[model samples]
Target: MCERTVRFSEINEIKEFVSAACRCKFDIDVVSGRIVIDAKSILGMLSLNWNEELRVVYDEQDPHFENVLQKYMTS
Candidate 1:
């Protein structure tokens, strides 16, 4: 698996992020501290309160997953 830190300072950013990843087949998870939620689930992501750095994880062997994740990583 691969991981990266991402910040979503606005609700719209989070929504768009989720929307893009949800279109893919792989699972995407957003983690804050000890809490983890499915990135594709709007309700699950919203429950996290949109106020923290998130750890995004995806299977390492999935090339498409890595490509999707690269878009969210800090430059």
Candidate 2:
């Protein structure tokens, strides 16, 4: 699996991020502490801890996935 730290500072970012995730072919999960939610679900994502860093985890390992991931990746 591939994982990256991410953050969404504004409401629009969450929408865009979830939209991007929905386009992905593989399963994507957002993990924060003990909670993990379906990345493609806007409602599931919104319930996460947006105030802190979270992980974007995916089962696929490819350059295309990496490119798509750039839209949500945080420092």
Candidate 3:
């Protein structure tokens, strides 16, 4: 598994992130506080408090998704 910290600067970034996540067959989750949301679920992601930084957790790697993650990575 791998993890990264990411922060969305705009709603479109979230959409793009989710789009990339949807392409992966591996499990991906977005963690905020105590809430862990499916990365591919736009609604779940939208419900998150955007003011806080988020943690992305995934069990596998995909080069395309990694590129997308790099766009939003904060740490």
Q: Which candidate leads the pack in TM-score?
A: 3
Which regions in candidate 3 have their CA more than 4 angstroms from the true location?
A: none
lDDT of 1 by residue, 1-75 (tens): 767888676778777777777777778788888998998888888788566668988663455555655666775
Output the better candidate (1/2) by lDDT.
2
Q: Who is ahead in lDDT, 2 or 3? A: 3
lDDT of each: 0.74, 0.82, 0.94
Native-referenced Cα lDDT, model 2: 0.82
In model 2, how large is the Cα lDDT of residue 14? 85
CA deviation > 4 Å runs, candidate 1: 60-72
RMSD (Cα, Å) for all candidates, in order, is: 2.6, 1.9, 0.7
* Candidate 3 Cα lDDT to native: 0.94
Please, what are the lDDT tens digits per residue for candidate 2 over residues 1-75?
788998778878888777777777889999999999998899998888786999988888655557756866787
Clashing pairs in 1: none
Cα TM-score per model: 0.76, 0.83, 0.96
How does residue 36 of candidate 3 score in lDDT? Answer: 98
List clashing residue pairs in candidate 2: none
